[model samples]
Target chain A: MKLYDLELSGNCYKVRLFAALAKIDLEIVPVDFLDGAHKREPVISLNPWGELPVLVDGEVILRDSQAILVYLARRYAGQAWWPEGAAQQGEVMQWLSVASNEVQHGPNAVRLVDKFGYEIDKPQAMRLTDRILGLLESHLSSHDWLALGRPTIADMAVFPYVALCHEGGVDLSPYQALDQWFNRIKGLDHYISMPGL
Target chain B: MKLYDLELSGNCYKVRLFAALAKIDLEIVPVDFLDGAHKREPVISLNPWGELPVLVDGEVILRDSQAILVYLARRYAGQAWWPEGAAQQGEVMQWLSVASNEVQHGPNAVRLVDKFGYEIDKPQAMRLTDRILGLLESHLSSHDWLALGRPTIADMAVFPYVALCHEGGVDLSPYQALDQWFNRIKGLDHYISMPGL
Candidate 1:
């Protein structure tokens, strides 16, 4: 399996981190993100959206980090990572939407603005970050994992950007339960780290 | 099953539309969205996010429109709406992420700005709408559906906002393939319409 990757991207790190935990051998092909290589030629052909972290497994080429996590967990990691049944999968999927929407617009957007100099509203990003963190803290206060009382792709999907919220100038010190949840993920077997974390 | 619904929300309409297509009897408990009811006691108690279209079936209370779609499809509509196997689910999920991210920020964001008088960057929303619509047009040019060669939750998840793009003052007349895809969805059995559509 080949993953088109970027060193600092939380989205790319999501796929990489999950692969490590599941012990899947994945070849990382670094994209020249600084030179806009992702927007041109081969990478763009693989995913017209020109996004990072495109996974090519034989004929199955997938984009979006959350979607790739679903693919990896379901195809290789048995029911532990993603699980079976409607309610459980739906539970896992809620966090994936949060990852793509709340987490993306919050910490991820702020990180892009501060760390990478992307133009966006920093105040709005910070506000969203605080709001989502509060939600996560409340949820984690009663539950150990995001879904199914175990480590699932729900945890994997929402972990990266939230873990790296400091890079966006958002403090994690107040969210103790959320911080504990982050530590739990970090303590898992075969846990991996990206640049910010 | 009960759906905590708002009449104008595309996300809520997604569940309503899908339930109609699947022949599932859903009770619509209308939320007073205009009066900030969703952010208050009982509604906020159900979903910490306080978002509309919360599905309550027995002990399972699912939030997020995309997640609700997964739950309803897997439980009620069988594998046709969600499908089985990793590749097919992953294919469907790719567009789910697009719905949560691209569609949410693109057409949906613009619609909120124009139709509801929300404060947001109109130019940025239009640009995103154009970009995503272009991608959708290219994909729909040869394929009848968004994923797995048939109607799936992928189409349902993405259909509402795109169909309502005109409410955002974004023109869709130029994207013929995308328009055709919208018409195809409109012609589906038991398909229902929301306010903008």
Candidate 2:
């Protein structure tokens, strides 16, 4: 399988982190954002969204980092990375939605705003980040992982973006439970690092 | 199950629609948002995010409309509504993410802004709606449904807010494919209407 990867993006890191944890081998193709490789159709014909990481296995082309992680988990069962039952599976979906919306806009958005040199809407970003962190902290306080009593794709999808949210100028000190949860995910058998910008 | 509902809410409508389609009976409980009921606890205790359509199934307090849809789909699987398999399933997640993010900001957000008499950011909202509608049009051009051959949770999760994009003053004439797709979903066996403000 081949993955169109961006080293600094948490979304891209999700796919890599999942691949690493699952011990799956993928040939990584660098999509140089600075060089405008993403906009170039020769590369982007694989996925029109023009986002990374795009996973290509045979004829299937999947976009959205969360979608890719779900794909990986389902394609290879016994990874214990996906929920087996319905309620737990729903929790996985719930967290994925949260990761994309709340996490994307919260700490992740703050970080993106900083990285892209975009003006930060300080009050909105802070409130959103605090709300999301509070949710994460409260949930983590009672649970070892995000959902399903074990490490699942939900955590794989949410953790990277949130763990690195401090880059957005949001302090992590308040979410001690979340901080501990992050460390537990790091202690996984095979883990990869993001080359932060 | 007791559903906390708000008539004009797309999120709330999606859950009710799912319940209707799945034939899972729910005890409907209206939340008077105009009366500041959202500020009250127990309700706030269900979802700190303070969104509508919090499903209290015995003890499981599920927030986030998309998550609730997923939970219903998985928890009651033998039904005809939920998508099956990886590619189709990934497609479900993809549309779910789009509905939560792009749809949330474009149609859903605009709807809220207008209904609540908030100032309109016409240029920004128009751009977002156009981008989203364009993508939706492209997806619907070839496929009959959002993520599955049949109408699945993906369509159920997204259709309510998206079809009402015009409620937010978004022009829908350009999206022929999506318009047809909307009609198709509305043509479902147990289609329900979204209440006006």
Candidate 3:
């Protein structure tokens, strides 16, 4: 499998983190975001949205890091990462949506503005970041993982951006349970880390 | 199964629309959005996020309409709605993320502002709406459905908000393919509609 990746993006890190934990081999194909390679041929051909972390696994090509995680987990990792049961999948899926929605709009958006200088609504991003962090803190107070009582793609999906909140100039020191959850994730076997995380 | 819904919420309508199409029975518990019922007890207890479209099926309770659709399709419906294969699931999931992220931030955010007077960035919302609509138009021009060459939860997840974009003052007449896709979804077996669609 070939993963079109960017080193600094939390979205791309989600795939790399999951692959490391799952022991899946991927030929990392780095796209030049600064040079606008992602918006050009090959990358844009694979994904018209011109995003990074596009996975090309033989006949299957996927955009969206969360979708790519689901594909990789179900295809190579096993049921442990992306369970088969309905309720289990639903439980895991709630976090995946959060990863795409709240996390993206919150910490990730703020990071895009602060670190990459992308024009975005910083106030709105900060507001969403506060709300999502509060929710995660509340949930992590009782549970060690995001869903299914064990580490799954749910954690993988939401981990990178939340862990890298400082890159967005948002403080994570206040969230004790969230901090511990981060430690647990970092302690996982074969775990990988990306820049700014 | 019970769906905590608001008749005007596109997110809630996603679950209700899918249930109707799949012929799944749901006890629609209308939440008073205008009266702030969703933020009160019972509803808030079930989903701390206090979002509409909370699905309670016996022991399982879920928030987020996309996750609720996944649970319903995999459990009550069949592989026809939510496929079992890895590639298939990933294919459908790409659109599901689009529903939660792009569609939510774009059309839904605009609707929230225009219809309910939400204090959101309308210019940003309009920009995102145009981009997502263009992408959808391009995709729908080539394929009849969002994924698997058939109607799946991918379409269900994205349809409500896109269809209701007009409520946000988005003129949809230019995109013939998207209009056609809308009709296709409207023509589905046991299809249901909400206000402003």
Candidate 4:
């Protein structure tokens, strides 16, 4: 299995972190993101979106980090990471949607602006970050995991960006519950760290 | 099954469209968006996000439309709409992430601005819309569907927003391939139409 990786990207980190915890062997093929290699040839051929963290296992080529997590969890990690049954899967997927949308727009956008010098509305990004973090803090205040009362792909999908919120210039001091949740995920067996985390 | 729906929301319509095609019996409970019903009470209790298109089936309560589609497809429509196995599910999920992120930020944001007078950067929304639509057009130029070479939840997840791009002031005339793909989805068995379509 090969993963098109970027060391600093939280999206890429999500897959790497999951692969480590799940004990799945993956060949990390670093993309020359700074030189726009992802936007060019071979990468574009694999994903029309031209995004990093593309996972190629045999005939399966997945682009989105959330989707890659889904594939990895379902195929290799068994039902522990991504549970079966429609309801539980849907519950886990709700967080994946949040990870893709709210988490991406909020913490991820801010990170791009602060870390990578991307032109984005910083104020709006911070607002969105606070909004999502506030929700996470509230949810984590009473629960240990994002879905199904267990650590599923929901945590894997949302963990990276939220843990890297500081790099995005978003303060995590107010989110005590979220802070503890982050630590809990960090303590997981075989957990790996990315640049910011 | 009960679906918390808003007639004009593309997110809600995605579920409705999928349920109609899949022939799942869903009781549509219209949320009074104008009266702030979605943001209040029972809705918030079901989903902390307080977003519409919440599906309540027995013990399950799903908040996101993409997640709801997953639940409905897996539970009722079998593997045809969502597909099984690792790679096929990931292929379908890649577009679900797109629907949650790019489509939500692009065409959905523009529509919120133009139709509902929401405060959002129209230029940014249009740029995002153009970027995604251009990619979709290029992909559809060769393949008949977004994933699996068949009409899966990938098509349903992205269909509503792209089809409603005109409401967001996005002209779809230039993308001949995208138009054909949209028409093909429209011609699917048991397909239903929303307000914009």
- Residue B175 miss distance in model 2 (angstroms): 1.7
**Candidate 1, A96-185: lDDT as tens digits:** 999998999898998999899988877777888889999999999999999889999999999999999899888789889988899999
Give the clashing residue pairs of candidate 1, or none: none
Q: Candidate 3 A-chain TM? A: 0.99
Across residues A1-197, which tens digit of lDDT does each residue of candidate 4 receive? 99999998899998998899899999999999999999998998898788998999998888999999999988998899887788888989999999999999999999999889988777878888889998999989999999988788899999999999899788789888998999999999999998778
Give DockQ for candidates 1 onward, in order: 0.81, 0.59, 0.88, 0.85
DockQ of 3: 0.88
Best by TM-score: 3
In model 1, which runs have C-alpha deviations exceeding 4 angstroms?
A: none
For candidate 2, what TM-score does chain B get against the true chain B? 0.92
TM-score (0 to 1) of chain B, per candidate? 0.98, 0.92, 0.99, 0.98
Model 4 ranges with Cα > 4 A deviation: none
Ten-residue stretch with the least lDDT total in model 2 chain B: B117-126
The digit string of per-residue lDDT tens for model 2 on A1-197 reads 99998888899888888899898888998899768798787667887766677888887788888888877787765538766566666778888888778787677768878776655454566677898898889889999988878888889888987888788887888789998898898888898778652
Candidate 2 wrong stretches, greater than 4 Å: A118-123, B77-79, B117-125
Candidate 3, residue A6: lDDT: 93
Task: Give candidate 2's error at residue A12 in angstroms.
Answer: 0.3
All candidates: CA RMSD in angstroms?
1.1, 2.3, 0.7, 1.0
lDDT, candidate 4, B98-137, per-residue tens: 9999999998999999999987778878889999999899
Better structure of 2 and 3 per lDDT: 3
Residue B172, model 4, lDDT:
91
| Interface RMSD of candidate number 2 | 2.2
